[model samples]
Target: MLDWLITNSWLVWLVLFLLLAIIEMMTLDLLFIMMSSGALVALFTALLGWPFWLQVVVFCVVALMMVLFVRPVALRHLRRGPREQATNVERLIGEQALALETVTDHSGMVKIGGDTWTARSSDGTAIPAGARVAVERIEGATAVVYPAAGPGPFPAQ
Candidate 1:
């Protein structure tokens, strides 16, 4: 088995590629997957009858190239994704709500999409109950809202 392995070193590269690819799946960090690409190149080099030392050099260079160059581009593309990929909390921005109680800059409550939330007035003014509001942003567990145009910006509490 050892003699056969010494002669067929491509198998070693193939195994290394598989192991690294598996690690990439677990980590999702893009590093291990870059090394796996190097292992794939080394496997091809070995298949073409290259010396082991040359195959090692090829693997190292290719892996270094991927890590230094391709990884950043891949990360940027991943981050760019789609605009609609905003999270649920992010989607809450600009959504309409109703002031369940008087909403002041200090404390209040509002209902957004049928869900109750701790609320604050973005402009530090009191918004009366039953007033329509729009979410400006979420700070911690609180939603900051502004009086939205249309009905009942009533002065309640």
Candidate 2:
């Protein structure tokens, strides 16, 4: 079996390439894909009657080059777009809210976008309930807010 493998080494390279490709699909990290490219080169070298050791050396050099050079360019191109969108609590900043309770510098509550959140005065002043406020930012679980101009005077009821 060992003698047959030594003589038909291209089969080994082919099997290695397939294994790397399979792992690449599972990981999606581009590392195994680069290794599969090296295995492909080694496969060609084996078909050309190169010694097993020489094929291994070629595979190592090619894989290293791909990882160090090609992978960066590919990742940069793949990531070429607008910066990542803000998520979760970050989306609350700059929104307007209604003070659900008398919001003071130390503690308060506000209804923001249909959700009630703990809030604090941005300028350390009290904001009465039913007042309009703008979210300045978030600190931990709390919304920091400042008084927002009220809506134009209601039409005479």
Candidate 3:
């Protein structure tokens, strides 16, 4: 059994490659993919009749080099993009809102993005209803707003 396994070492390397590839899919990180590339090198070495220990050494070297060199480049390219992609509460910043009720420095209500939210004035003042405001930031469940520069109320149809 041992003799037959020694002769069929390529099968072991191929299986290792497949397992690493499956783990890469699950992890979505580049680490496993780099290791799988090493496993592929090991598989080729096995096919070329290299000894098992030498194949493992080659695998280790290749995987280490890829992780130390290639992975950083790949990650940099993958993450490179526009720095601004407003999401969730971040999208509300600088957005216009309508004061639904008298908003004071401490407590009030405003309609932001068509949804009502507790609000406070950024400059600690009172804002009357139907006034246009700009969301400065969100504090807990409240939106901090400032008077928007421009027309106050929308024109009636």
- On TM-score, the leading prediction is 1
Scanning candidate 1 in windows of ten residues, the lowest lDDT window is 148-157
- Pairs that collide, model 3: none
Q: Considering lDDT, which of the candidate structures 1 and 3 is the better prediction for this target?
A: 1
Q: After superposition, how far is residue 64 of candidate 1 from its true place, in Å?
A: 4.4
| Candidates' C-alpha lDDT | 0.92, 0.88, 0.88
Residue by residue across 1-157, what tens digits does model 1's lDDT show? Answer: 8778758889999999999999999999999999999999999999999988899999999999999999999999987656488687787888888899999999999998868999999999999998899999999999999999876433333
Roughly what TM-score does model 1 have, to 2 decimal places? 0.57
Per-residue lDDT of candidate 2, residues 39-58 (tens digit): 99999999999998899999
TM-score of each: 0.57, 0.53, 0.53
Q: List model 3 lDDT by residue over 19-129, tens digit each.
A: 999999999999999999999999999999999889999999999999999999999988764537656787788878888898999988988766889999999999999
What ranking of all candidate models by lDDT puts the best one first? 1, 3, 2
Whole-model lDDT, model 3: 0.88
- Please give the distance, in angstroms, between residue 8's alpha carbon in candidate 2 and its true position after superposition: 1.2
lDDT leader: 1
The segments of candidate 2 whose C-alpha lies over 4 angstroms from its true place after superposition are 82-157
